[model samples]
Target: MSNSDDSRARDRLAVMAGIDVDNPELRRRLDAISARTAERLHQPVSLVSMVLDTAQFFPGSHGLDGWLAELHGTPGEWSFCATAVRTGRAYVVPDATIDPDQATNPLVTVDGVRSYAGVPVIVDGHVMGAHCVLGFDQHTFTPADLAELQDGAAEIGELLQSYRRGDTPA
Candidate 1:
């Protein structure tokens, strides 16, 4: 499918799955997950973000401050997590400042996001969003780190699926 078509389908499934971006309870749970992931990975920031058509929404986040934290999201063009969703795999940038694809990204230039790693959060065979970690300094992620990140993403997927089934409180 085309990128736009895939985005639309993912958005539809997110809605059908009852993923509420603004639900405080859900955000709390997601933030807990993000915090754990950040601590485990020794990263400064972590987020469970849903990549929508117009933006990437951070339903769960840790170690954020200022406007980005307040907004809980960024424009689609500013998302590193979107690459993971689109690829249905992990996307890693060891140093955004040196990566041609990421050099000019606002998150890199303005937000000082020098390193990033994200794994796709899949639910029912569809790519939903991502579980990602960020670092202000350049850092390379190992295979083990990717595996751990993927485990976190899987947990997020299960959490969302449970909500969709009404097996958990919203």
Candidate 2:
């Protein structure tokens, strides 16, 4: 399929996932996971971000401040998580300032996000979104760090699946 076709399909799946961006209970559960991920990874910020057609929604977030915390999301162009969703793989930026693909990203140039690591959150065989951590200073993530991030992503995927099945996740 073409890129646009693939994007459309993914967008459809995101909609069908039925993630209520404003559901306080869901947000609280996801926030707990985000907080744990940040503590485990020793990162300054972590987010459970759902990439939609126009934007990425932060249903779960930790260590965010100011406008980002208030907005709970950002436009798709600013999303590092969108790369994870599109590729269905982990996306890492060891140093956004030096990476050609990330050098101009606002989260880098504007928000001072120097490093990022993200893993896809999948549900029902579809790439739903991402679980990601961000750092203010350049940090080269080890394989173990990625593994821990992947575990967090898996937990998020399972939670999303539970929601899809109309079951409250414990």
lDDT of 1 by residue, 99-134 (tens): 998999988898899999999988777777899999
Taking the tens digit of each residue's C-alpha lDDT, what string does model 2 give over 144-170? 999998999999888776665455655
RMSD of each: 2.5, 2.2
Q: What local lDDT score does residue 165 receive in model 1, on the 0 to 100 scale?
A: 42
lDDT accuracy of residue 61 in candidate 1: 94
**Which portions of model 2 show Cα errors greater than 4 Å?**
1-17, 165-170
Determine which window of 10 residues in candidate 1 has minimal summed lDDT: 161-170
Deviation in Å, model 1, residue 66 alpha carbon: 1.0
Model 2 vs. true fold: TM: 0.90
Task: Rate residue 108 of model 1 by lDDT.
Answer: 89
- Candidate 1: global Cα-lDDT? 0.86
